[model samples]
Target: MKTLLMITGAALALAANPATAQDRSNDRAGDIQFKVLGTAVLPDGEIEQVNVDIVGLPANTQTAASDNYVPTIAVEYFVTHNFSVETIAGITQHDVDAVSGLPGAELVSDAQLIPATVTAKLHFDLGDSIKPYVGAGPTYFLWVSDKPGAATIPLGVTDTDLSDEFGVALQAGVDVALGDDGFGLTLDAKRYFIGTTARWFAGDVLAIETEHNIDPWVLSAGVSYRF
Candidate 1:
């Protein structure tokens, strides 16, 4: 009878240990991450004009650019071991020059704060060193620092009433574990598609509206510590 009692106690202790280990693993499943990101805009389509204003100039003049840069801050919340939700906030600066008309003439040189986006991502583990992810979500843009005097033309950007932009985010990267204590380095790349409208008054003479389609790609590298 004593031998049977000892055997039962050993089985209960073994069961308790696995449950405790599982609880510990669940506690460490979620992670909070921060990343510094750099982005470049790829301009394939023309900047569409919703409105236009010309003082004494011709109405046929329009401006375009080849490329632009956008840098951002990314914050991610891991919901599970291999899934997360991420939010990104960034600023973009563009130098818009009239394609055919100007000799060193800059039409618009300004910085605008891009809207923030929240994305739901699924991460894939490739062996022990590589992890890749993909996500899609909605974005909201807010325009800041519109200075009419800074441009060659007197076109005043009164406000940029940006709407809610729907976008998709794709990301892939590798995590280099530093040690067993949960310190690691991460490098990732992501692309976002965003669109908005710029509302402006041309020197109090005419009101012009412009629609901007911005597709930005982000590259980021950061360190993370898991507890």
Candidate 2:
């Protein structure tokens, strides 16, 4: 009879603890965070092709070399503690010069492009300080300017029609947390695979077609805040 009475008293005591009950409720609130990042383009790529077909210039005498160094900004939102969505925007500038081996002919041209992208990311925590992640998505390119000189061909033989481009991205990064106050420092790397079609024209005359594949590397460091 005494054993039964003691068991009843212990059960009543366990049922009266309010702290344990409140902890379960707080666990369902989830974790949401925001981050801002800055990135720079790393020099990475080989010249694929350069085609020029204009009057008064040798058809096979034109070529181009790849350019690097681009800057970008990104804003990210965490849907949960381990998942996030981000949007990135940036601009890139390039300069190409044509050399004619046929005596004295020199030509130089410059171009620029701005691209905006949206991506989804997944995060993994390694402990209290380190978090590594990966991301992928799509992008749209806006052709800003295309300026060329007349020494290689003619003054009016400039191509400025580079249509919109489409591509995908891949990324990986690590975050180092600052204390327990939802603050951290982050370092990351990303690759974007983008391609576009370029059309050359002499006033109203269609000259040549060139396909451009731009694959650029990005390295970044930033800070993050969580709630």
Candidate 3:
């Protein structure tokens, strides 16, 4: 959060500079912008429903997934001065641990995720150098791989799987142009509404099945270039 604040402050300061306002326009249609960013993926991994409990999990069992930080790349194409389409690429890893009934017990380990997303954005014209945008789109959360946690291994758990699901995302962000060379800074935030089903098997027998809410907030800050 501190990093996001610092980047946002820097972008705002640059946008307010009179020098940047006169440094050539950043309003070119049919242009493309690329960004390299540091991103934080914060997810809520609470159990929404328990479908099967052959292993006899305790009542009031709850779980949470760990947060992850990773580098990401974003590509955007301008359809007009105030409208664009954007997409991002990145992979993140997480762990799900029991936080309530069985505190500190790991239930899922090394879960790799790829969030494939695309958004159509509407940029509001605030000034020549400063642009703020709002966007919405669909996203697919793909699970690459996952393993049953150590705690579950003793329960004769042989495998674990997380279902790939489709969801929607809402985004808001600001971009500040630096100069005529098409370099700038950007800060963005996206909220995702998603869910997944988790299954655990022991020798081909379904030991557990659970429905989880995996909604996440993705935050990013980075430098951007337009061409």
lDDT per residue, candidate 3, 146-222, as tens digits? 99999999999999999999998888798999987889999999988899999999989999999999999999999
| lDDT (C-alpha, whole model) for all candidates | 0.55, 0.60, 0.89
lDDT of 2 by residue, 94-122 (tens): 55444333323323345667767787776
Q: Pick the candidate with the highest TM-score.
A: 3
Better of 1 and 3 by TM-score: 3
12-48 per-residue lDDT for model 1 (tens digits): 3543454322233444356887765565554422356
Off by over 4 Å in 2: 1-38, 42-52, 55-71, 97-110, 149-155
Off by over 4 Å in 3: 1-27
RMSD of each: 13.3, 14.6, 5.8
User: Candidate 1 versus the native: TM-score?
Assistant: 0.66
The TM-score between candidate 2 and the true structure equals: 0.68
Q: Which ten contiguous residues of candidate 2 have the minimum total lDDT?
A: 19-28
Model 3 TM: 0.88
